[model samples]
Target: MICFMKNNLIVSIQLPLLILFFCSCSLLNADEGKEFISIFDGKTLKGWRKAPKTSYEPWSVNDGVIRGEGKENRLVYLVYSEDENLKNFELKFRYKMVTKGNTGVEVRTRIDKTGKRPFEGYHADLGHVGIGPGVLGAWDFHFGSGTRKEFPCQRGTRLVIDSEGNGKHSPIKDAINITEIKKRDWNDCCIVAKGNFFQLWINDKLSSEFTDHISEGRLESGFIGLQLHDKGMVVKFKDLFLKKL
Candidate 1:
């Protein structure tokens, strides 16, 4: 009887130890991923500029949030820039909608003082609904303005850039799949842009995968912006951290 009790204790202890070892290994494997950078400092818009606005209201960084209040069907943008060049880096941020509307992170797009509608650019094309058709994962030739009648060109399609970072868009990346994260709740988004390929991870789950080739523009590196749709739209972002992998 004594020997049997001792054997049972050994088995219990060994099982717990084995469980712990496997858990540690899982965490280590997760850490071994590509590099990334966090554009938001959660303090101020240090690397951003309040670009030309189409409305009187503007985008601002306050207490670590990049926020916008939409107006006139034009939610302007606050853009970012860096003196150094960047390539093949992932960016992560948390976005929460104060109220449901349209918004998305803008990448590889540019604007001038005239607020000339994302001059020569691409927008992520995000709304409350997720459809695998647009610049990021879906397509609708949605020009700068909204329209009931569709254009001759397709909308909701992703863009393509060359090695020099200049290119036009095509349907090479077929469709984008997004994780249906909860609205008004803090959800993490990861964007990986490498040459003509980009991938998106939502809430730590692989969502959209994009690979395209275009020759209209180059995307070696460019400003990042957060946009809100028309007026009364508000979204909050926080705890944005990135490590270049």
Candidate 2:
């Protein structure tokens, strides 16, 4: 009986330790298996190009950052065409608004050759407060008919759109506080797109959540771009990373 009790105690201890060891290894493997790829070279615009209709001439790279000085008469875009047709992926980058009017990151976008707007897609909106209502920390939708829907998913809101283009939203209590966004400092932005679900995080806080069931209006694959909204807006982007999910 004494020998059996000793063996039982040993087994109990060993079992817990073994389980812990396997869990640690599993976490390590999951972290190591992430396949994030840096999209920007930080030295030159090797894999990106300016849109054909971009009248602005101030898009440049300096000090390992992509800078856009919006001095154009209209909106312009710097497109990422190296892998234009990305279906579902995760994108992360850091941005700083030097002198903000309005700026945004475009995903699943296509250039409209004969349209007034430069591209058609979903925009992750960012701008200084008082620029406009939908210009800051929201999701804007642009369609081919020049239909722009601003603030479909606002900051601190969770939204769901039905197949017929109907939407419903509610406030998320734990979402990012827009006041925490720095005016003249760098901010982190992360976008995750999987199937019909999309999430946007700013400064590591959930800013917006969206699920699109609208098959007709949804885009499955398209290019990415950085927007220069009108004139007198200055923005910089760095550390652009993408992971195919």
lDDT of all predictions:
0.51, 0.74
Report clashes for each candidate as comma-separated counts: 39, 0
lDDT per residue (tens digit) for residues 169-232 in model 2? 9887778776878887888777777788777777767778788887865777788888888688
- Please report the candidate that would top TM-score against the real structure: 2
The C-alpha TM-scores of every prediction are 0.60, 0.81
Best by lDDT: 2
Candidate 1, residues 65-137, lDDT tens digits: the string is 7677676566566666652244554556667777757767666554432443554233444554342234322
lDDT, model 2: 0.74
Candidate 2 positional error at 232, Å: 1.3
